[model samples]
Target: RTSIPINSVDQAIGAIRTKIIFGGLVISVLAAVLGLFVSRRIARPIGQIRTWAESIARGQFQYRPSITASEEIEALSVSLSRMAEELRERIDTVIRQRNEIEAVLSSMVEGVVALDMEERLISMNQAACRMLGIRMSDMQGRSIQELVRSTMLHQFVNDTLSSRKPTEMDIPLSSDGEVIVNCHGTLLRDAGGRQIGAVVVFNDVTRLRRLENIRREFVANVSHELKTPITAIKGFVETLRDGAVKNPKDADRFLTIIDKHVARLEAIVEDLLRLSRIEQGAEQGEIERIDSRISEILRTAVQVCHVRADAKQIGIEISCPEETRAWVDPPLLEQAMVNLLDNAINYSEEGKKVRIRVTQEEGGMVISVHDQGCGIEKKHLSRLFERFYRVDKARSRQLGGTGLGLAIAKHIVQAHAGRLTVESIPGRGSIFSIHLPTNPPRNGSASHGDPLQPS
Candidate 1:
């Protein structure tokens, strides 16, 4: 090895140390820059995910996190987005089901009410509010006894709640008079099979009860009427069979009496059949109506009653305009008019005039029979048109009155959309009138005339 100068050797060693120090500085700067870029790449996605999670916690499910830096980050973002969508869908489904249940309850016709186990009113339908005469605002959280004044209804709710089973009852509410309601109650339970509430439904049955009472009364009256005439006929027949018919005069008298009873029975049966047919026709909407002159109907009825009037020495004086007309079933109108004329002739004193008057007034025509007879009492006038009803039963029987003629006449007039009314004073006379519309309204139409006023 060749020996070099010592100063030159020292300068070479310093130059190598400077170069190593420069290289170290450059490497340190590069490493610091790489660390900052990697940290930013990781923290940017993490920051975005945190923001999305906070928004979701605040019920903003529409927010979605996005991460494109790494596959793991992207997977996390997709999963979070799917979770938000699923949660929103489930919430939406629950809300829709709740609305559907509310809608179904609102549209019900029968009164419906729901109460919690604490006896607080949870919900009520429109019909329930109407039936109870209360508002929803007034009924909320109120106890059953507090809202409903009826003791029977309160007891029914209590019974349902205690039994945890369905119960039914008929309750009478007396506001104006008596209104009957059919109520049914059932326990409401949750998914855990735990009783949570009760639901009550109410249906109005007032008209049904009234109809039942009327039906019962009609049956009783009909039985009594039929028995009376049959008993009389049987007694007369028994008298004849017991040898009272041995003498010609006695036999003739008994035969005449029996014939009269038979005629009365025939009249009753005929009137009953006619009344039934009229009611059936009215109910089935099968009445055939036509425009007929009122004068002609009155004249025809007068002719039919001519022989009876002659026997009673009662003159039927008709006063009707020739041009007056009514919308009616012609045969039915004639029958009703004849019944009125016969009643007038039978009730009037001999030598008295039975005036048959027809007048057109106020969108309708009125045909009346005025008789000078023992007029009806005020109490009897209300029920004069009822079947088998009579003010003087003995006098009606003696005059061969079946007690159904007025009832038949009333029904016939009603079927024609007309009214049969009576005006009377006990000592003076009675006026029986039939009011018929000139242009009767069609069935189910609302623009109809007012009902007849009581006289």
Candidate 2:
């Protein structure tokens, strides 16, 4: 029975071949899956490297591509990693340099504004905004023409942008003030010398201009001061020689006029010296505890001008709260108050009343001098505090004014970290105000007033 069960060789061969074919199909399917996994693995590493390289070119230092391959791709991955590291280092260095330049520009007292070739403001520091009376947030990225109001500055910027050269312009920033800015510009180029854009740097010289104007005014004022007395002396001598002596009364009158002129001239010289001393001392006026003797100062100023007020039939009124007080150098405050009061007296017409009021306003105290006199025109109001500026030059001389009161007052206010402003309308009246902080700045900070308030 075992012999008869034996199969043919051909049947065995066919069974073996079928098993081999099935085995081959299984191996082929497994190979396809393995190949897909391997390709995905390789492609993922390349993609990660590509992403990192893109980030590096864009100046990002955080991209760190991993290296896991062990073939030709591995070597390429190593090189890419090295390149990314070097790129990060260079980018960090550039950032540090940029920050240093920004710090220097921000610390300057004068303004600095930089613009790109597109005529848009690239950047500006805090001092620049302050000097221009603009907010930093609003000034950045704006067109140069939109930001700068002065035609001189606009034209100068256009010329500099086009010419790519350094320029200087005396830009009148305000009716009361002018700024001298030294502008420098150049085209920004890439390493290949291809023009990318332009850059402009604006350096403010407003304070320098103000100082120069002061010096000019001083010279002219001194000359006029000297000439007034000399002219009076000549007039008196002529009157004495031209038979005025025949009438002792007229001769006495001429002599009295000459004496008055001499006193005025002497007073002018004395004021000039006082102002010089004050300005020199201004830088050294170390922050100190100031008295709040607002009432006492007001009383003294009013008392000194009382006789004059009575002569002009003008009454001096004091309206202030008992708690009114301010941080102030008493001497400086008293002097400034005297100047304000004297100005009211000089400007007020005869029989018109003047009022002096003091009270707390917000974080500060305000002292307002109100006069019902020939009010100043709007155009002259801004320069009212300027040295030697006069609304009526003839009337100022007649009133024995040295034309230095308002200037002295302005300096005193500045030294005290306060603001002085005037509001007037012709044929109506005027109000001159001095606002000072209520608290004396501690630790002797030069910024004695509140930072929220700009003087």
Candidate 3:
């Protein structure tokens, strides 16, 4: 080994130190770049996943996150996307079911009300709001007592909830007891069969009740009317059998009285049969109709009642255009006009005037009979068209009136798809109008006329 110079050795050691330091520096730089790249690779996917999660929270299920750097991260993103889709499907199902339930509730005709366990109104349908005379928007979440003023309805709801069983009640809503509601209440339950609340359904039964009452009254009236004539006939027959037959004068007087009653009975039976036939024909769509001059029909009716008018000294006048025509059953319409004219003549005082007027009105033709007589009271107008309904029973009987004339007239008008209306003032006068529709409705679908009124 050659003796090395100190300068040379120092240079060599310095170079070695420089080389180590340079290598260490290069290693540190390369390690830092690798760490930075790895950090960015992990952070990018994480950031994208965080953004996707935020979008999902905002209900943006359609947003997808990009994560191709790491297989695990890509797998995680796919799983999260599936989860979001499932959540969306479940939410859609819930919304669909809710809409279906709402539709069912809205279309119901009967009034329906739902209450919570606390007796607060949860929901009410349109029919219920109308029946209770309340607004649905303002009634929600209110107590039942605050919404409905009826004690019976309140009790019914309470009973339904407390009993947890079905219950029924007939509640009267109107002050005059005209509006009656049949309520059926049942417990509301969840899918798990847990009692949640109560639901009440209301059906209007006022018309049904009125019809039932009319049926009962009709039976009673028929019985009384028939009994009166039969009892008289029986008594006269017994009198003839006992001793009156031996004396011709007494027998003749009794026989004449019996004949009068018999004649009245026959008239009643004939009128009843006519009404039955008219009703049957109207219901079966069998009443024959033809285009006829209404003036001719009115003239015929006047001719039929002229004798009665002469006896009462009631002057009759007809105001109609000869060109006026309508689709009508001639014989039936003539009978209706005859009944009205006879009534006008009978009810008029001596020298009173009975006027018949015909005119074209909107949607129909009107034939009105105006009588200058003791007009009907307002209280009796509504029932005047009912069979055997008389304002003055004793006076009607004394006049030899059968009490079936107005009823027959009404049926005939209805058969022609017409309405019978009356307006009267107690002391002024009365007008009975037959409103015949220009175009008749289908058979058996005749519109019931509005209730009679007093002017």
Candidate 4:
């Protein structure tokens, strides 16, 4: 109020105008600076956020946003980085799990096949490739009928596809080979019970089925063998009581027949017991390294059956190389050799020759017995080693054979970790070979000497 002077109108007007201009310019400059700072803070953060989202989409969540001095922006950047890292880790875990599952499915031993309702192969493992003899890629979208050559398997797969039920079947490969496949398939469904696809699992049971067949044969043979001896004993006893008991001479004749029957029973019992022992892990304590002198064992067997061989006029011949040897139990091998010789003498024609040969084979020794006998038919060979199985029931009974000799030999050979094989013709000569391991038992009563090498 003291500075406003009324003395000069021009000075007062100029002062008021200058002060008004200065105030407006100062306000304008301040507003411009404020707008620039606000736009930078908003636009810069949004750009960084957009780039981070793109990085996550592209599977690279490695980028971290720089924090600004603005508290809100810094907090937002920290949260965004945490979310991106979590997403990356989740995606990585999923990839790793998928790889592990794929590896397991590819390496499975069974033939794996998945299908849609259309009977086409959706997915299959590597083993399925080998089993079906087709490439995995080739089978992926192909119809089952086109891939499966076997009619039975083709039909089974079709049935499963139509019915959405599981099936199992046996498939034969050749005249001498077969496999049992237990297939289980289920209709895949979503939570709403809508049909999606099917998964099939295959389990192999070939060995188990073979063992069951062997067991059945054993039971049948045992029944037939026991029936013969029991029938004979009953007949002879009744005859003796009716006539032979009154006359001493007649009684003596009957007694001789009875003694043969008793011997047959004793032989059967002994063979059964021996088989039991062999099956119980071979009593590792009783194993021994025995003589491999094939000539000696064969000669001894011939001597034991000399009377029987002479009665039939069967000529026994030995052809063993001096260097041939085997690792065996002395008593067991001698008995096996004796059984073969006895069979030869009993079944051969008059004046026909029987041959015994010892030779070397891979990993073991081979002792063979050949006979010009009434040879076994092809069908009977499969059950020759079964207990009490016989090629000719009447002849075996007449000869007082218990029909367990071959079975006993087979068990003993298996107990020693060896193999037994036979080749025969219906009317020609038959050859029986016993393959003995050259190596002795690791834990047995007798110490292993240098095992005899086949020459």
Candidate 5:
């Protein structure tokens, strides 16, 4: 703070100012360089974290970054990584649950369909697609009406959306055919207990309904058949007791008529029992099988039916090689053959020729009986094997036929794991064929071979 000459003092102040300014400039330049280096060091890790966050945003949660910055930065990266891992695990769990649900729905036999609030198809299983005769790819997002075209199904969907309780009905579909499906409808709900959509389950009950109808018809037919003979016998017996007994000739004739009815009743009962036994054997796999010469079995069956054939003056001509053999239940097969021959004899006119032909086919052996008889109409052929089903009821009864011979034969062939089919042209002739597999299951083990051709 010493003052010299005025000019020198001013000069000294100016030199001090210049030096202070130079020193301040040097310090600022050095500080700026150091700050830049520090900023680069910090920004390197921050930029890497930013890149990692971007990848995570793009759904790359499994991606990792090598971040070796300050402890605070490292802790932050670790927390972010943990959060990403949790998010990834949650997403994987959701995907897995969705797949599991899809699998369960696909394997179900009953048809299942899911609809959104707007009645558009959200999901449909394979069975549902098959039942509805629609493709899943074509049906998705389509309205129920557009897919099904059934009034009852649409009503059911509306009911399902409005009501929480499940409802069921039989819906008839005319897509492929007259298919009857039993449908069960219920509302689908979300986790928050809100109504989200509806689900309908379909079960094909057409075969069950047909079987029920057949059972009812069978019961009715059996009752009618039994009542006819019973009523006839009762009426003849009452007539004999009233006045016919006073005359030996009338009494004898009434007794003979009663005897015929009794015999008819016995035949019906016996045939029914035989049918029941054959059905049980077929169901329980109790039909014992053995290798036997088909010609020998055929010959035996011919002998059993020769008496009836002789009465009708029908000549049965057999055409089977002696060496041809098959795995068959000999006694059962022989009985089946005898029944077929007897039926042919009963239906054939006097002096008619019946041909029994046996040949090895692509699938297996075939034993067919060609009869020059009154061929059945196409309508009656389908139910020819049904018990008590007769093509000509009056003629069948007049010929002392039990109306169960063909049914018994069919059951016998079925027990052998075979199919019995008939081909006939009206006013021409009839051919009844028994299609048997050559390599049938032996000793409780199935043996693969050519399958039966379509009939």
Candidate 6:
């Protein structure tokens, strides 16, 4: 209703517009500031939680999130901390179990190989590496066939994987030398019984096979030896019963021959028994050991064989220090020495010299019986100590030899932690020596003892 000038009215309108715009700008600024503070408060805790989660994913379970803004965030941090601790414990347990499995595999004497589902080698123990002639580094992640080059092994693994069943075979490897290994392959399965891989185990059976062969041969030899004497005795007895008993001279001769054969049979049986006893004693660890003068043992052996040497017209020579000492079983050592002396005397020609010598050698004492006789051939030396093994079977029987004396002597010496060896040249001479330890071990492991000076 009040009439104003146009300039004044326009100025008033501009002022009111300016004031409204200023008020709006101020309100917008206040809203922006409050929004920034609220957003920052929420984002800061979330950022910390995210960082903590990332750390956990990276296996940093030792780190903890610190959140103080909200109860929900604090509860989440606590839950996360507990989860990390449980995970760490479970991981440590897994690592410990893996280490224990590794230790058990390493200590095994038999070879063990583990392969992954991809047929790659995952683990191999020391014995496995040694048996296969490969290094651990070279075998890892490599195919089993590439490492072992054996058709049998490859087939075994494939069969086990395909059937999820165990398989076994004897594999012969001749890389470094001939080796027979008994291999067993089995499937490795997960907790759900799903086949994951294959495990192959190997055991060396070469020595066991050889021992079995020896046992068979020994049984055959014993049967033959026993049968021969029985057959001869039966044949001679039947001949006497048929007619020879009627003539006195023939009867007397037959009786003499039968008596000689009977005596020989008795000797053989006795010697076999003695050898068996000695071997049993050694195996049972029941050898009687004593410290005795070496000279005394040699003297006793010589005296026992003096009559035989005189009968054969052989001269006996002794060469040894007077007071040399050794650890030995007195009776067994005397028996061993006597057997050697008897062998030397029986094998020597008439008037040949048989020498009994004792000397201190490297870490031991050597007692040798030397004979100037028809010596042993090299081919016969390897089995010279075997029971009933004779270089000249007829000659040995003619000389009243049982063929078990050397075998018995060897066992006796071995029981005393000694070795028996022979050196000979055909038609020249033979020397049978017993190498005894100077100081025998109180336990059962003595082979060579401390060195001793000749007294």
Overall local distance difference test of candidate 6: 0.85
Q: Between the candidate structures 2 and 5, which one is better when assessed by lDDT?
A: 5
Stretches > 4 Å off in candidate 5: 1-36, 175-177, 444-455
Better of 4 and 5 by lDDT: 5
The C-alpha lDDT values of all candidates are: 0.84, 0.77, 0.88, 0.77, 0.89, 0.85
Model 5: colliding residue pairs = none
**Compared with the true structure, what per-residue lDDT tens digits does model 4 show for residues 1-455?**
46745667778888888988998899999988898988988879878888988887888777767756477877888888888878888988999998897799887877788877787888887776766677876876788778777776766666665665566666653345576666666776679989767767766667788888878887887776667677888888999878778888888888888887778878888878877876764755565656456667677888998899888888888888766656677667787788878877888899999989878878887888899988899998987887777888889878877787787777777767787889999789799898887765666545544565656
Flag regions of model 4 displaced more than 4 Å: 1-84, 103-110, 127-134, 149-177, 191-195, 236-259, 281-285, 290-295, 321-326, 374-383, 425-428, 448-455
Clash count in backbone of candidate 2 = 1
TM-score-based ranking: 5, 3, 6, 4, 1, 2
TM-score of each: 0.70, 0.64, 0.86, 0.72, 0.88, 0.81
**Model 3 lDDT per residue over 1-455, tens place:** 86989999999999999999999999999999999999998999989999999998998888886578778888888898889999899988999999998888788878999999999988888888888888978886799899778888888889999995699989998777889999999999999999999999999998998889888988888777788888999999999999889999999999999999899899999999999999999888888776677888999999999998988888889999877777788899999999998888878898999999998999889999999878999999999999988899998888898889999999999998889999998776789999997664555343333232332
In candidate 6, the residue pairs with backbone N, CA or C atoms under 3 Å apart (3 or more residues apart, or in different chains) clash, namely: none
Q: Write the per-residue lDDT of candidate 6 for residues 1-455, one digit (tens) a residue.
A: 97889999999999999999999999999999999998999899889889988988898877776688778878877888788889889988998999998899889889998888878898889899988888988986799888888887788788877775678887777664358889898898889988789888999987786677767877887787778777888887898999988988988887887887788788888988899899998888887676677887788888899898898788888898877878787888999988998898888899899988899899898988899999999989988998878899889878878788899999999998889999999999999999998876677633432345565
> Which residue runs does candidate 1 get wrong by more than 4 Å?
1-107, 117-119, 175-177, 247-250, 282-287, 306-319, 343-384, 389-399, 419-435, 440-455
Off by over 4 Å in 3: 1-40, 54-58, 66-69, 439-455
Higher-lDDT candidate among 1 and 3? 3
lDDT score, candidate 3: 0.88
User: Model 2 Cα displacement at 154 (Å)?
Assistant: 7.5
Q: Which of the two, 2 or 6, has more TM-score?
A: 6
Predicted structure 1, TM vs. truth: 0.70
Error of 6 at 73 (Å): 2.5
Clashes of each: 0, 1, 0, 1, 0, 0
Instruction: Rate residue 317 of model 2 by lDDT.
Output: 88
